[model samples]
Target: MSPATSLTRNQKLAALAFVLGVALVYYASHPLLLCRQLIIRDDEALYARLHLGNDLPYAWLTESDYSFRLAEALLQGKLGLTEPPPEWVNETIPLRGRYYSVFPLGSVLTMLPFALAHRLIAFSPSGAAIALIGALATFLFLRFALRCGRNFRDAVWLTLFSTLGTWLWTNTAMGGAWQLALGFAMTGELAA
Candidate 1:
């Protein structure tokens, strides 16, 4: 049998907690790593808000930018864009001569505060939000693993496999609002 399988329950619990701490640190920093890789597009600059390397960190002329736009609109006490969308924006429905995002409202709400506090989040609010939700998912996963009473080695392996082996990493790597909602939903799944 492996040495880990022979540890006392308290030892196992302590080790699991330490592993969780390390996992949290990793999730917290994951976004910064992702952000550094972003190449900002000149057109995306106006709404880029926070600039890492002063670059556009999002997709242009795509539905991916909808949440950011929705957030900007919500800040103005409306759900639809006040002015015409640029030719690049998509996945929106036209209503009452205004354009609204076709994506879930959850994304718009998630981006609202960041849009509202555009000056405070250091130009990467979307990334920061993704990071926060990712960390929460990590915490939930660790808790779930611990509650299952798996051995220390098994627990660590599970967390690593889930984080690296799954598309979870891919979703969090981008700053899209859909990705954020997906990550948040995954966090909810972890809690269940």
Candidate 2:
């Protein structure tokens, strides 16, 4: 890689900082957190520092848990749910004795690692995973923007606009089934 094309040390640090900022903003954009609800009791100690109350798991926010089942099925080498999903899975369809998610496989595949983690150690990974995808997608955008322009600061502003000024803000923050897929699609587009 040519020196002119590659990021300098300060530019790399700035890009990483931008990614971290994106992650923090997206995670805090959750509706419950935004409202400053007393329901975010978390192990991270962040809520304590912020002086917020509430458990981390929000029911509406977890409507996308069905996505994990699809990811898990893929891990097991199946395109369809071999075992029936829980009764609460609303957006699934039963076809020819097989059940599948209404969301496409691509979206489900994006969350594959989170599903694998949940299956392996029974740790809840969806919340962390969504923020991670959001960060990764933003990081990709920063790289692309910097490549197209010579100024890293200008790239940061453009990237911020793309993220904050678009529907991505709501969709990625909501963390719903469709939203999760959209985040993956955006990341895939940025990657391309």
Candidate 3:
């Protein structure tokens, strides 16, 4: 192939990669997937409340274990905490007489933008944000595949397989607190 033609082809391939990555992420992050509450005992609900300016340190005490805490925290007033609940009794970090999530803050930090957007728009945006993260993770995996001397086609296949054909898909789509944390950790390692 001519030099100019090869360059143009490469550019096209790069664009295709980006577009496909974005489209797949969008598809996976739909609210339909999020509304099902596949995993309830997750940090996403807590983070969402925190981003919306609700008191996080004490909210968990009254929130039901089976109910959608994010929706309740957003719409309802905080219930009076007469006593620490069973869930909170064991998992709290006491700081300055306030309790906090035992989970790390990384996942919450990652979802901050989405939480803010959701707060503003009155809709959950976690799915989209998680999808974007997953897409970026796929791109990083693609780069890693290329650096390992994979052909363009093979690298693309590897990226798809790694992101979609593994637990990565479940974590990204579900966007549960622990799942997202695991996804972010794995993606961070891959990107690094």
Candidate 4:
């Protein structure tokens, strides 16, 4: 009932909607976001070839930074947040190659950690594990959207817009098809 609260109530929700819309642009691209930390440590060709080759022991080690290689070799099966690189490489973010040139480079990076995962978990559950991660991300997104406003109908519409918007769909087509799906799901919630 205070003057400030009244003023806030008077403001159009359009601003909130616009912010959510712009946020949807970024959210539609979440899968690409998670991979940035890893990508910062390695080049495009090295990681792509490693992934395409199925994360072979020697190949992964050679493509990965020294610390990442050492840790992956030692603990190939653990599941948790990875440690940052102990050292830096110049021009670490490569801009060349098919995946990088086309997609935003996030999908590749997001897949990077899983390369070493083969050494740890049973191969049978890997697909399931990745799916679980995607589902969890989607859940988090829904929670965030609910917190943004009380209008359930409005939130649902926004969710659809953010999840299936052009930015995400186009980017997904460019590269990282799987990541695009997961990322759009997570971001859609936030955008809603």
Candidate 5:
């Protein structure tokens, strides 16, 4: 074949390799890592509230315990707590009968797309979309690696190791509030 054709074919092969490598890493990590329940937890619940436009009660931030508040919020037709839990009764923050969330909103912003889709689909699988995000992050990492002058083979290996052999897989699969937040942050940073 001509040189141009050979180069084009080689480029296609490289692209295929990159895609397959990312897929392999994502699959080997399992679709769900440490998540046991489909119900949202911790900061994830807060993010869900944010997505639903629910007001976060400031009292919930007084202590680490949030399960009861979340349950109450869900029961009250609110996405998050509407009242302060007992633990915050003594605090001096002068809540003035208002709800709030102490956590940064970055993670919630990152999860908005997924949250919106979940809202649209009544029965969408809970953790699968996050796994896909992890996979996308791996793909981006591979592309970034290649752009940094690593050979295609080296880039593939590096991407695999970074995604599967590190906390990236754990966080991506677990779907914890912080883990998902960190994953999105890393993915965004790499893309930038």
Candidate 6:
């Protein structure tokens, strides 16, 4: 392949790497220290809630906090792979009902593997991993957008702007991984 073709392949691989790394890091850095009930923050709470009660595997899955719930679901089986519930109801997985109807369903679908992996290891760990992954996706999406414009110089300028002046940086700093990913995805989509 020519240099241009090789460069394109690398960029594609970078995108894949970014997505996978986000999922893995989220899994590894997950707060293994905290208990499910003690997690009070809205986002964290949502994940904690999913695996609660008789719901067990699907405890945290809910409609109100769809994206985070979806993230949690994605991390279910990778680590230890939680034992299958005596009965599995697809609906119990949380975030499946209303979310699957309106949105593109891409994000929700992308989340399943990680959720399964984390569910296997432990619920909280999976949640933390998913959150980190979402944040990483947001950051990388922004970086990709900046780099794809004009040339390297223009890419640098855009990156600086996104880092300093945009919500991209703020969302990540605030630990709003979903927001980061949403903003990046929306901005890119709109731009396109």
Which structure among the candidates has the greatest lDDT?
Answer: 2
RMSD of model 3 against the true structure: 10.1
Full ranking by TM-score? 2, 1, 3, 5, 6, 4
As a TM-score, model 4 comes out at: 0.30
- Candidate 3, residue 108: Cα displacement in angstroms equals 2.2
* Per-residue lDDT of model 3, residues 52-167, tens digit only: 45444443323222112222332334322223435534554545544445555455466555545666675445456566667777668767776777666787788788877887
Instruction: Indicate the worst ten consecutive residues by lDDT in candidate 6.
Output: 77-86
Error of model 3, residue 22, in angstroms: 6.3
Q: What is the lDDT of residue 130 in candidate 3?
A: 62
Q: Can you give the TM-score per candidate against the true fold?
A: 0.66, 0.73, 0.57, 0.30, 0.55, 0.35
Off by over 4 Å in 5: 1-80, 83-99, 123-126
- The 10 consecutive residues of candidate 1 with the worst lDDT sum are 54-63
- For all candidates in order, the CA lDDT equals 0.64, 0.71, 0.55, 0.38, 0.53, 0.43
Error of model 1, residue 71, in angstroms: 2.1
- As a whole number from 0 to 100, the lDDT of residue 9 in candidate 2 is 88
RMSD of every candidate to native, in Å, equals: 7.0, 5.9, 10.1, 14.2, 10.6, 10.4
Candidate 3 backbone overlaps, count: 1
Q: Model 5, range 67-100, lDDT digits (tens) per residue?
A: 2233334444655455554553332122556554
Candidate 3 segments whose C-alpha is farther than 4 A from its true place: 1-99
Which of the two, 1 or 2, has more TM-score?
A: 2
Cand. 6 Cα-lDDT: 0.43
Give the Cα error of residue 6 in candidate 5, in Å. Answer: 11
Better of 3 and 6 by lDDT: 3
Best by TM-score: 2
> 1-192, model 4: which lDDT tens digit per residue?
322233243232543454455444343333333243334334355457446564333322232222223333334443322343223222122333211122233433445455456557633122322343333433444334556653544554554564345454344322223434454444554445
Candidate 1 differs from the real structure by a C-alpha RMSD in angstroms, to one decimal, of 7.0
